[model samples]
Target: MSAPENREAFVRPPALELRGVTKRFGAGASAGRGARALDGVDLVLGEREFLVVLGPTGAGKTTLLRTIAGLETPDAGSVALHGRDARALAPADRDVALVFQNFSLYPSATVRENLAFPLAAPARRLSRAEIDERVAWAAKLLHVERLLDRPAKKLSGGEMQRVAIGRAIVRRPKLFLMDEPLTNLDAKLREELRVELRELARELETPVVWVTHDQAEALTMADRVALLVDGRIVQTGTPEDVYARPNSPLAARELGTPPMNLFDVERKDERWITADGVELARADAGAPERATIGVRPEHVLLDGGPSDAVVHVVEDWGPSRVLFAHVGAHALHVLAPRDCALRAGDRFRPTFDVRRVVVWPRA
Candidate 1:
């Protein structure tokens, strides 16, 4: 085959695309004046891709999802699905499933009824047998079949969430928009559901846009992560790529656990030194004279060097210990093995993993 033929063969359109999408809310004193919830956001979702929209609270993650689901109108730009413009499409016509953070179900209704409600829509035109089959399939897939006969209000929080998810999956929509569906669950349950939902999406071969402020969910579940801040998409890349090479300091902060350690520094003697002449790390060959260097907690090592760090606190995180300490006048967080016996007030030396440092121009 020729190059052109190869290219044409794999040129299928993306599952979803947003071009300069912007949305605003709350008209102030002026009729058209309002706060920007989304500012010229652009993104693309490949067929069967799981893209996580990672951001902080009030960063417009929910607004983005709502706009995509047709529940909110964008003030500008276009939304497209599978190469077709969705401007004229209503919420139901879009054939997209949106699962919210709160478990949405009729408390008085049985789990089976809740799961079957979506199928009962007149537009679906699904036969009774087909509806039953779909509900059964979704319940089995989500492992909520045992609770099918119980009322939604009688189920545990985890169970109700499962049924709510079942309601969405029963439709088998072309796209899935999940808005932090597991945020309300307990930690262990959230972890369990995260893996389950990821596998389910893969098995169904569905494209999903999952929104979350939690970096753990984004890093563990996303095929790609879009870092949103201040109503704009700062960067988008695979989880590994974003974590390893964040385009900016904000992107670095969006995907880390305790977040990256960022501080302004000056370049001198081929190194980045802090304000007090404490060398932070080796300078990149093309690093600017003044820039910010970001070091991950794990990259800050307690090497017993001459850095003079006083431990402010030690947090045991099961697999590792996090040491919050002050090195000189700058406070830092360091990661150590769980077996380390460092206590508060203990003095130690901290070293930066120079090879892993990330630098950005000073802002």
Candidate 2:
């Protein structure tokens, strides 16, 4: 027989771990009692994991990163970085790098100086050759080798953003925290950098926690996504898993553009009855007695037997079309092909595969 495996030997500790992390701002009557920036937030970043924190505006995504970077102290909870308590450490002592949305480059410095600043500090005390080597490596990695001599203030938004990333790369931190780094760039530049960032994450072998409100960005770049709502983590899973199966109504509302249409239904004998008394096929046995039926816009099909609603509007996109329809009192959105002949005031029926439907229990 082969040698017995050592489970302990194979076990690797998390790169970053948070337990019951809570942070509040202000107190008493002067500051409106108090406001909680983060409440009982707990998360763990596995070794070499690229975790994206996704949420809407005012979801405390930035606060979470500030807490981990030691910029904001938690009112309660512990932050363990590489198995060491990091709460008492200063921002620099934490050995973490943060890339902000607005590229925080020094206006007076050249691209080379900004990239060299982290290594030039007295604590690091690196030799001239070592610092030069690191600076050159970062410049090449970010495709900013030609801009090294250019003043930071003179560079375009995209160029400055790359330099900001280069600054972090030279530090070589254990954890990388990016707060909407691509938000300021144009659409094309955002897409280009997104691919580069994903590749860099793999080559560096460092844990990264990226914060963004863009669904497309999260779906494309994340190995796993942590969905936050009102300062709390509502769900965490792979992009494919969360998109295909949302656990709650709140999740369905947040994931898509038009979002998942939820229809409240009542079970009547073996059939399900809509609010307007339209009877549909019965849900499978063992489903909740009272639940909401959810289906995506793209899944709604128009070629069916009955006309349940009238098309209110049609949005043409060359390749496909989006139909806005009124079904009883509820408004529904359907994604249709460019060949769709339905127009305004046209009656149509919406249908979809049973397996594609997501059921959310009401009771």
TM-score for each of the candidates = 0.93, 0.93
Kindly list the per-residue Cα lDDT of model 2 for residues 217-244, writing each as its tens digit: 8899999988888888888899987787
Please list all clashing residue pairs in model 2, or write none if there are none: none
lDDT of 2 at 96: 90
Q: Which lDDT values do the candidates have, in the order given?
A: 0.89, 0.86
Q: Model 2 Cα displacement at 235 (Å)? A: 0.9
In terms of lDDT, the best-performing candidate is 1
Please give, for residues 114-172, the per-residue lDDT of candidate 1 as tens digits.
99999999998999999999999999999888899999999998998888888888999
Clashes of each: 0, 0
Model 2 accuracy (lDDT, Cα) = 0.86
Task: State the displacement of the C-alpha of residue 250, model 2, in Å, after optimal TM-score superposition.
Answer: 0.7
Which sections of candidate 2 miss by over 4 Å? 1-9, 26-33, 280-282, 305-307
